[model samples]
Target chain A: MSLTKHPSVGEFLAGCEEHVNPYRPARLALCPMAADAEISDVSTSDTAREGDFVILWGSYTQIFGIVLKHGEIANNRFGNFHHDEIIGRHFGSRVRSRRGGLWLALLRPSPEFITQSLTHRTQIVYHADISLLRALLDARPGHIICEAGTGSGSVSASLSRALRPNGKLYTFEFHEERQKQAMADFSTYGVLDVVVSQHRDVCNHGFGEELKGQVHGVFLDLPAPWAAVPHVTKCLVFGGKVVAFSPCVEQVDKTATELRRSGYFDVRMLETLATNWGVKRQDATKKKRRTEGTTGTTAAQEAEEEEPKDVPKTSGTGEQWLSYQMPMRSHTGYLLVATRAPDGD
Target chain B: MKAKPTLGSHVVLRDLEGAQKVFLLSSGANRQELRMGKYSAIPLETLLSCPYGAILRREADGGWQRVRHSIEVAEETVEVQENNQHLAQDNSAQSLSPSEVRDLKQKCSGSEVVEALASNSATFASKTKFAQEKYLKKKAQKHVQQVTLLRPSVMELCETYYKQSRNKVCGLRYDYLSSLLCQADVRSGARFLVLDCAAGLVAGAMAQQLAGLGEIYRLFRGSYPEKGLLELDLSESEKSCVRAIHLEALESSDPWSSEWLRLPEAPGDAEGEAIAPGRAEARLTRITKRHNDFKSLEAKAVDGLIVVAEDADLCAEVLELGLPRLSFGGRVCVFGHHLQPLAALQGAWRAGNFVDVRLTQLFTREFQALPLRTHPFMVADANLCEGFILCGSKVGEAEPQEAAGEDSPTKKQRRS
Candidate 1:
């Protein structure tokens, strides 16, 4: 279940007949997981097979693993699941462990699940920011997008999904080791065909001369995104979008100014805050009696009467489910979105 | 190259006051017109030749003229007052009367009118630089009859509908819609079962993402709602991807044999007028396409299921019928305005064959980033609650042995 045993990018590429363009149907034909079936069938099917990746979701934990090696096992606190049990099962099937008898649901790998379970090499973009970015960038089929400093490949996975079937993503990361790891992860996740991860500091060298005026969108998750604004303009086609994710307001100000100065129109800044609500059943009858008693009782007597009691036996009909907001991360980062206008307007 | 608004294509006209109106750019007898305030209505034909994002201003002669270049007003750096304590509250700030202003507006262009008003304000010289800019911008909004033509993307369309009528779009904020799409992993070549009660906005948004590569089975309660969908400038291929099916057809024991699956006959010619031959042919073609799409959907599992209904009970019923058709690991996102029903749904779904069940509420705050003044907007929407979302992934039904062991200690722990 460990990625350490997976083949390196060079080794994996050497085994392929030609370069892999994940968007092309021919490239998917060469994928081992899709070899036994047509590309469309394999991509759309929910059944897990050998060489396919799956998420083992337990009550309190989630583990990502590949369905390979006949006798291999996925060891976790809940149980130890054999790969054989997972290979032929549907993605949402619950499989029990051999010895512990504990069970976990077998899930199909998605970008959101991967974001939660993937090994973190750096702070990664969560679901909220990634969703907004995809929408604002207009990432869709046939689009070619560029991302700088592909930290953790969190956003990359989503962009890859957004540009599925034919589009391409050229991602740049300055850290050599992180870039290699991200490439391996993408390969494992079956998105390497649509993504090209490279080791380059885009702020210094730019997104390569070949990409000049070719990309439909550019995304910057760097510390100083303003430094790459000029480079973004060169690579992005006229009317293309550019999004910068910055944690601080000062960075947004500088980036917005730079984008406007570079003739980008409709510069906007927004913060997405998402809160999870906890749903619990509240007993209705007890609450009515308590309210009636509280009107005449003294404050101290009410406090004494409110001492801990045994867990109430629920009368299902009288129970009501209520939701309350749970504590959440107040801030992730600011999303600054702007579109490049036609030149010399 | 920028995309131009073709004849008969829909475009959004945004006025300087931030109000928007959707117009079809066409010429001849079927031409459309946009009312410019209480005075003028300009034919949309004047915008067919302009590219998206082009700005047009109302001339003094009541004709629409395209602005070739955007005028950049340079801000003069002046010593500004820290507070407005010295400013007088008298209502005699403007030297010109309302009648005189009206006469000026009728004789001069919008910018000229704004300039005259600014010059006539007796207190304009003493106001802070920011206050002066705000005053000018407000005045310009009132006087300027300028409208910017924009392409109808989901973001623009959603904002327009949201501002005009929140209920029409089910109070779906743009961010929430985006989040739902992402959570559902909507993309090209992916099939989705969508129950869109939001005037086809959800289906249109998904069609944009599908980009003609996948299928969208738009389940409707009755006749299809195409008001929001028609506003989108989708190519023919993209339009083909959306297939409208009656909800009754999906709920029937055998959808193929259901009467609801059959296309209704075209309405009888009213007042003895004959139906156009071309229109009859188009109706036949549409019905045949729907049948084909329904057959294809029946044979395969969808990648995701999305239900946007005001009634939580309806959402639950649809989910129950749709879950069997959803692929394993496929996402289910149901949106409702009230939290009570969604919370009840959350409790019920956790016991079913689903994983990663969550109820989420989103809050989005926009900030105005300026060179010197960057802060959150002072005025907020009156309705703070956008809606609640219940999301989960469908799993396979438990096997016999797993069902037997469901009452084990682990099950008790989960409930606790």
Candidate 2:
């Protein structure tokens, strides 16, 4: 893997030998800041070897790279990082450039890293939608699930993580190119076995007998979920669930009507709206403070509180908290969930 | 085969009358009947024996539709405007007396009753199709046989408490809680410290997110932790991940009081000294090991920290004990009812031990989605905790900025 001033991403990814799987997405799993863990401790059995898919994450930035032999260079705007420095080092080790002017940690790749940083082929599902669907569906370990219209493999990634250790996800994308692209991503992230992608119309041809009447959950991100309802009904087990993610109310209306006749009960439509706040530690309260104080996130508010005005300041006090701010996401879309009949068993 | 809704299982009970109550069903306990009024106290037993999430109805009625349509009816295209004024202008529209309608219900289903009641109306032939549909929709609510069993999710639990007793729960908005979980970076196999305000809503969710794989220390106030934790309906493994600690005890030099460690009193033996069963000994061993683990935990750091405490004193203790214990890059999340505490926290973080200091307040308004008329609900917001939160991450001292990709490569790269 030579350091080209402008190396193609595909070329770089093609040469990688292995990728990180069984990852916990939200938090970076391994780093020096993390507890001291060997490479084997952080990685699955099919761990990153020479040419494995590894990411070089700086304190604030990340670059996907190949795990190659000594003397090869991974050069970016930052500097030239020699392959020799990280080839024998552990996955979570912090390595510096040849001159030691810059530093980055050799870290494993997560699905989120692939989703947020990878190139997209279509409008993908958001993390909020994915997690909410997982929660609403009560996807448990060993629950086999089906997903249609795997647009950009965004939902596929989270599903792969959510049903880990035992479960598997059978995902389908109608378009050949997109399905092939998703397959590439699954391989890139080392989750090929966990998520099975197919290039077929699940609505026209029901999920073959391997999945017929046995899936724990089904997610439809298609245009006409009503058209797919019958196929999904045949695939879902007793008390299984189907969630149709439609942007339009009219689609939900048709889907609901079909589900009413499809022997599914307790069908309801919901819209997921998630909000993220900033929570941080302030300096420890320096004094026994007064009881009542108005709260605001303005300069004047902080300046107004020079002292508690009633209590004396002290040394060696602990930290305070600030819990005010705006959210990271707004409404995603309306989600409709319906359960198959319990008596069907 | 799956087990029925057991004593410890969290169940959302929908009585025959159609009111839903969410709670943990205890066996052989005198309690409010699931079907209400004269339904007997065996509600819990019956519910446990039945299938989980099965609707339990008091009475069964699969009646019929008897419509008198002897007269020839012409097909008419009649569209009704909403709340047609002319229909409401006149009175005395029904030929059947009230008792006659009740008699009809005894012999017919709600749809049948709607048909009979409509056919006998004085203005039945004069009304529009939409009006008739609306009338039938309203009538169905009164007669539909529905029940609720187990929808033990965070959303259902939040709504149940928010409507019943707002103060009894933390009142954290559903989406806001989800976002907090995401920001806290809560995941399986991640060690965390959680301080619950009142209802253990946050604490319970964290246990689920961890899925019993990691350690979870739950800090509570008063003598015991939140009773709402029962709402989580934790299995044996999920419950094992949770440890409830008195927040006040953290201030004491020996946080582990003797009370926390005292084994359950051994049953009296008249003739000989009784050795504790292996189960009891294992429980003691777990408690003792956890005690020592907590002692050692004070010396190291965890993956993340979450604080939902509203008490000013408790908030301070949570931060004092939680912030330093977070490893670098670990998330710190605080959810409260007001904005002041969160804002004050953001200001304090100007010292820059942390980065990505974010503050957010989330309020959600639901919309009624009908075929033609879709609008915001009259009550725009649910009775929710004035959900204000702040989340950020531990960062080592700030790194020097990279201007852009435009910057020339380092000199060392050329030689290499």
Candidate 3:
């Protein structure tokens, strides 16, 4: 083929190549940052207050920050930061706690920061599950993801971060209030720029099969997940991944049966658990010292030292102990991951 | 030939594509067929043995719907599996009527007769075999899954991050009052910035009358990646190119300080690129690298740089230094929770901040889409660990700011 003989068409093609996609109005929006915009800083001691912005860290070095607005503290894994020195700091300025702790002040808060923190009326997938689920599904940027029971929009928030700018999420929740909350939260988190929440119920009305195909992934967390399997099969792209989170085994069994019968391939049920840990100075006598100070010492120690009975040894010599396991969000729900079966036997 | 439809039989219908057609019976009806149809649909669900095969159908709309299939019927008893496993294992033999036995034996082939006899005596044996096979397949899948997750050592993780480090900063944030200890050994030489998501009240209280960190240096604001770009009217290729360029610009800019990476002073002996004759090549390279690292895509808004040029390097350094210094398990917290500004940032980057590039299968075309931030190393951990860590009274009691006296050090001085 002559390379340049078709000059006009070639030029037109080249011009077309340089053209940028027009802004999408339906499911997504693109918002550019200040050339000096930052990712926002997240750290200890400096709590991010309500109406403040913050970033979320995840596996694959994924970073998403959002500003806080409404919602209780239980929704986002990064509990609400209503007030803190780091709340309004610039990208590079240090966000240190009054306790003299240091923090990396990265990018500015995300638009969805508050949305991600909205309260969930239903059993919601917390932050840990969000990261793990994305990893398990190999969900990449620009992949279409589906979520049912948008519950405060937390999972949707994470999914929006995973699918941003070019990706779209069609989230469904039967509850109007929950949907409103989710939408508001998504707006707060900036994830609203790419998400759609509907007031339809998958179990009753069915997923919009005609409107959606090539759905890259699906997340189901509903009361009767089995009832939605038919719709799930209809909308799920071939070989697409679907994850169902349920707390009970019976639910898993029913859901599995439906999926298996529907010919969804490779469904595996699993769960996520995270334990809290405490880091403190370690010394041999740390335990003994804690016991001595708290218990006010024992006769054995006094006998060994041969100290006067009346002598009060207020100073416990046990090595300074600095460790304890804080309460952790140990159990959320069991996860069942399955793939849509390929065509033909 | 049509297989005889029996009551209480269970069946499923599918099209050639294997997609389930209408869940109907050989009788062609729903669960309420008994009331709707002249003849009630076979109640296959309750039957121990179903004689008819499922149906398949096509519709004018396009995809296949439900019809019916041909299946042979026999008196031979066939075992059933439930829950992908044997539901029962009954070995009791109940003699059938002589006439019924003869009918059963005559109906099936010799092998089927044996199968029927065996099924009657030990119901789950046949189903058990099928169940066991499925179980083995499941076990194999689990093993493969385990192998996939087989994690590398922390050093390996660090090295992976290092290899992917276009920008040398990792920020972490956590809840208030969670054990706030940073592990230097684990993050030595790494720019691990840490934040406490609880800074609002807890950190504010801890700061007391003293000026807080935010008060001292509030520079660049954070911008969140916006969702909903897939609805744009642009062609798939255009969307992708814009997305890639936007992402590149985002990465090239400093993630922490609202600035882009700057080339180190060339005079230093450290690894440095030579300055371009008239161009800030070194600086440009740094900028490009930062762009590459903070790759983002936006559709609705004007595309442009995220951070001001002057603040790029300073922000980058602060992010680089602070993140690593914080102990392992430490977290970083951002305060603003609004989405408008972040959405605006994404819009600008998409419209003007980036140069179009070549890409494929990157932009979502067919279905509702979402934007995802990809990094050379790995994605960020989305599990914000700070949410639940500060739940109890410890979070309530700390009040570090209120306790800290501006002029005095009343704080307990624990020897490190």
Q: Could you tell me which 10 consecutive residues in candidate 1 chain B have the lowest summed lDDT?
A: B68-77
Candidate order by decreasing lDDT: 1, 2, 3
Q: Which ranges of candidate 3 are over 4 A from the true structure?
A: A1-28, A31-117, A280-322, A343-345, B1-416
Interface RMSD per candidate (angstroms): 10.5, 13.3, 23.4
Best to worst by TM-score, what's the order? 1, 2, 3
TM-score of chain B of each: 0.89, 0.72, 0.18
Which docking band does candidate 2 fall into? incorrect
TM-score of every candidate relative to the true structure: 0.86, 0.71, 0.41
Please write out the lDDT profile of model 2 over residues B128-177, one tens digit for every residue: 65455556555555654445565666656765665566666666655666
| Model 3 lDDT, residue A66, Cα | 51
Per-candidate clash tally: 1, 23, 200
Instruction: List DockQ, one per candidate, in order.
Output: 0.27, 0.13, 0.05
Measured by lDDT, the strongest candidate is 1
lDDT of 3 at A148: 89
Give one digit per residue, the lDDT tens place, for model 1 in A100-214: 4577778767788888888889998988888888878878766899999899999998898777656789999999999999999888887876889999999999999999999
Per-residue C-alpha lDDT of model 2 across residues A213-279, encoded as one tens digit per residue: 7798899999998899889978887767898888888888778767776766666776654454443
Q: List the candidate numbers ranked by DockQ, top first.
A: 1, 2, 3
